[model samples]
Target: MTDDVTTLAWAYLSRVAEPPCDEIATLVGEVGPLEASHRVAAAEVSDALRERTAARRDIHAAEADLNLLERRGGRLITPDSDEWPTFAFTGFGGAAVRERPQGRPPLVLWAIGPARLDEVAERSAAIVGTRACSSYGEHVAAELANGLAEREVAVVSGGAYGIDGVAHRAALAADGPTVAVLAGGIDVLYPAGHSSLLHRISNAGLLLTEYPPGVRPARHRFLTRNRLVAALGAATVVVEAGVRSGAANTAAWARALGRVVCAVPGPVTSASSMGCHVLLRGGAELVTRADEVVELVGRAGEFADEEPRPTGPLDGLSDAEKQVYEALPARGVRSADEIAVASGLAPTAVLGPLAMLEIAGLARRDDGCWRLVRTSP
Candidate 1:
């Protein structure tokens, strides 16, 4: 919880300047939110800061906004709040982020849910992709989300259609915590069809945004909100994306913040997968399953994927044994003389390998004829 004065100041400042306003954020960092709000109101800040807030400075809605948030059962999370994720936003202080206002951290977040921001972000992974997704993309997103949830790793995603929607629903279906970083206010559910989904998210997970109540989702706001989605997650996974999609923007933010970027490969002919293939070519980790993603974001050695190995019964056979096995007909039996001819081995030598294969259950003898045996993996 935030104190009355401080919360009001944060709310005021949040509205005064659009988010990612480096100038205002810098001013607040220097003089604190309470004084910063007063300075902006009094026009005592630098020209750059003053100009940014000029249009909305006098339109003070702190109290009203707070009341609306409370009425809706939401919280105003300021830097002063216990719920603020300081560790997750540490990268916002990096030189790269400071150079770009779009990548900077938020001054205040409007959130609604039962989960704590910091706790949910401790081991979270952001799953994002384009709004127009194929069934393949949807399946992959759901699988990754469900798998991460089962491992107790929170799933973070924009609460939009396609990949983001699938990820959120899958995480909730698995009875795991998830966080939906919205582009608009927590109260303003964009993509009207997802209104029910958004409310359900608020009940089970969290609906978070930097925008105040009544702020509708705008194009620029969605792009600006990408930074938070990237920052909150330890890793960002792009399940499917076009060459130029919002998911790609989120991945770029993750890279800029030094977070692990993972991509799931799709068919070579899929236009929807071009972005992921581009990422893979540029050295992003190629993640096909949740275990692979967990290995990158989870604690070292905790969720490591097992090394792959051949599961065939012939895997450990010697060259001679393998030749004998291969020489055997897949659907029918073959005699010793026929096997020897097919394997390029002596008729007498074929007997020993055939005996080995039969003993190993890789081959079976019926009426003294050898036929290949198919074993379940």
Candidate 2:
């Protein structure tokens, strides 16, 4: 019965690709609706599937693999299974099912991990960003992942390069469990370069996919998969992204689901930082350090060491100078406007203290913006 239900579900997903209701209804009709709530109008479903001829073919091919896997003694998990992830079910329920043409959730999820999906994702955060991330971006991603892991928080991300790669590596390096939700089949590492990382995650963390083995990733699938990343995590953080990058899609999905969205602020001039800045301006939490990321996850204590201590050269300065110094970030540049906002001081008051700090070599201007510089001999 599990086999039959699983096959029918896989076949249905293969048919609809992007949640087409008519195709799903047809499959549900053949499969007997597995559950009563999974139904939609056939005509509306058909219209939604009007332009997906190629996707339909891909679905058929994947169905064949499901049959092969079943023959090999592999088990299937339906929504009714005891092993089915409760958190995923919650996401399914919270998802905008009304907006989808199919009016159905995923047939079943294929997973390989020691921890149950719900347990692993009890307080998870998705770290997503560009494949071509800068060094600064990678550093921030690693710090955030490491902090989350040390706090026993699971880190979730796409198993891609740049930021994702760094995030996974940091979590693993810290001996923390992480989950990699793929756009392609779990068996097929899309970029190919991260095969080792994928293997490590399968052993130490979890590897998940909606697609069956041997299926390759398609363009639309990547966008569709982002929703899973957002839905699975308690919050989503974009370390870096281009203005129109897919990370934005994840942020949007997170927002729609009422999940906290966080972004690491980078150099204002960087093209990669543009997306994060946009997110920040749009009300996403502005995080320059890992503690800020942790705070968003309600795990601020995990990165307490990264927090600045109330001491050092500023200790010798007056209360007003200390206020100005405390206002400046530990790294990167900030305009006077930012300092004013952060310190709640007028621009006139900030200017006097800014000069005093500069003379003391505790701060310096780079490219017309002031930054807190570490004192040196």
Candidate 3:
């Protein structure tokens, strides 16, 4: 019975334009309440010869494919299946799958993974961003994935270049579960270069798609794919992106779906940072470090000790010295130019404070500039 429903649902999805979900719901009096059989019979299918001809062709093709899959003993999962993700029982999932003039979700999600659907939901977090990411962007993504893995958080991302690749690699290196939601078929590896990464994810994590096996990615498909990423994650983080990049689209989707949206701040001069800046301006939480992400996930206790310590000697320092100390990062060497930029002070103005900080043992100079040194506990 489940298999029959799956087949019928898949057939109906393949034949119709994304059904106008609201209209269908109004007709049925509840979202996703219309059965596949009912949908097929009630389609206000046009009688025009060309329209009818196309519909018939699509229906025939879907039926033929279903028969072949059944004959081959392939499994199918419908919304009624126990394995259906719990989110699917909510209005969000209904909205995702309902027919819209734009499109519909796959009637049956074809999946192969070590973790069950619910487990995927439990641990997932979407890490999305531009394909052309800067080195800093890559570093941020890797570090975030590493932190998430340490906490047993599952990393979810599109299997694209730049930030996506880094996120997946970090998760794999950490031996944590990860999932790559594809714009194409489970069998088709888009971009070709990430074939190894894709294979590793399938073996170690999960690889999923709305499209059936053997379908290649198309331009429009990626936009549609973003919704799935948003749906799957409890939150979405944009590591780095351009003003108009696809990451913004994914972030928007996350917001629409009521998922937490996070943006990692970068050098303001970087073009890739523009999207993140915009997101921050629009109320996305600003994340500068990995613990910020953990905190955003409400696991603050997991990272409370990782918080940045007070910059420098708070004892007996003048106001100016305190200001300079406060501006320095807890660790890492910095050149004078970098320190000046960070402190928002001229190099000349900073020298006095630097001398004070060094004498007070609140900071130390290495190479050319200053670094905030932690006092003994």
Angstrom error of the Cα, residue 323, model 2: value is: 21
Residue 119 in model 1: lDDT:
93
Model 2 lDDT per residue over 1-377, tens place: 87665556554554345432445545555655433123321322344344443345333444565665455334344555566654332232344643553233455566666656777766788999998899999888999999889988888999888998999999999999898888876568777999899888877888777666666888877876787787777789999999998899988877765577888889999999999999999988766655555555664223222334456566678545776887888888898778876875556567888889999988887887899978753
Candidate 3 residues lying further than 4 Å off, grouped into runs, are: 1-75, 88-106, 299-377
Q: Alpha carbon lDDT of residue 233, candidate 3?
A: 73
Mind sharing the TM-score for model 3? 0.66
Q: Which ten residues in a row are the worst by lDDT in model 1?
A: 300-309
**List of clashing residue pairs for candidate 1:** none
lDDT of 3 at 103: 37
Report the Cα lDDT for candidate 3: 0.69
lDDT of 1 by residue, 69-174 (tens): 9988999987888878864343424675667777677888999999999899888899999899999999999999999999988999999999999999999999
Return the lDDT, model 2, position 240: 99
Residue 260, model 3: Cα distance from true site in angstroms: 0.6
**Whole-model Cα lDDT of every candidate shown, in order:** 0.87, 0.71, 0.69
Deviation in Å, model 2, residue 111 alpha carbon: 1.3
